[model samples]
Target: MNKPVILCVDDEVMILDCLKRQLKTEFRNTYVYELAENADEAMILIEELEKNKSEILVIISDWLMPGIKGDEFLIGVHQKFPDIIKILLTGQADEKAIRRANTQANMYCHLCKPWSATELIETIKSGLKTISKS
Candidate 1:
């Protein structure tokens, strides 16, 4: 069986690298990690994964991107893949955007930039627990 996937999207390559390293260290072989630079690319990956019968268990996305804001991107993702857990990561997102994401995307959590690795892992763990239950 294909391993469940954790997809992270951020315009900044450095942030994506950091997230990948942290998630890899914590999750190891338990989940597959995928990275995309923007929402458009992420959507392509999501489609491909679905076509391959791979379950995308979670998405961690940055709020500030070139074309699509994180909230909008996540909302679109939720509309199509409602079961995938959505997480927002941002340093500059306004309250309204965050609230909208919570309401529209069923967002699991919002983590700020310069986030603690421990906290990020804990959040993912909590999300994973909820996923397991459902």
Candidate 2:
């Protein structure tokens, strides 16, 4: 059986690397972690995972990117796959953007950049709890 996926998108390579490392340390074999540098690439990865019959359980995305912003990207993802938990991990997103994500994307949580490992893991755990209840 294909393991559920946790996708993270960010423009900065270092940020993506850090997220991947932290998630891998915490989650290990629990979920397949996928990283994308932009929204377009993330969409492609999502489609491919779906094609392979993989369930995407969570998505953690940065708010600023070259093409699609995080709020818009999560909203798009929600439109296609409403059950996938969305989390915005950004350093500079405004209130309007975060609000939009909460209402439109059904975002589970918002974690600012420089987030602690405990905070990120706790948020993911809470999100997984919601998914389990649903």
Per-model TM values vs. the true structure: 0.98, 0.98
Clashes within 3 Å, all models in order: 0, 0
lDDT tens string, model 2, 1-134?
A: 99999999999999999998999999999999899999999999999999999999999999999999999999999999999989999999999999999999999999998899899999999999998997
By how many angstroms RMSD does model 1 differ from the true structure? 0.6
What is the per-residue lDDT of model 1 for residues 25-94, given as tens digits with 9 covering 90 to 100?
A: 9989999999999999999999999999999999999999999999999999999999998999899999
Q: How far off is residue 132 in model 1, in Å?
A: 1.0
RMSD of each: 0.6, 0.6
CA lDDT scores, all candidates in order: 0.95, 0.96
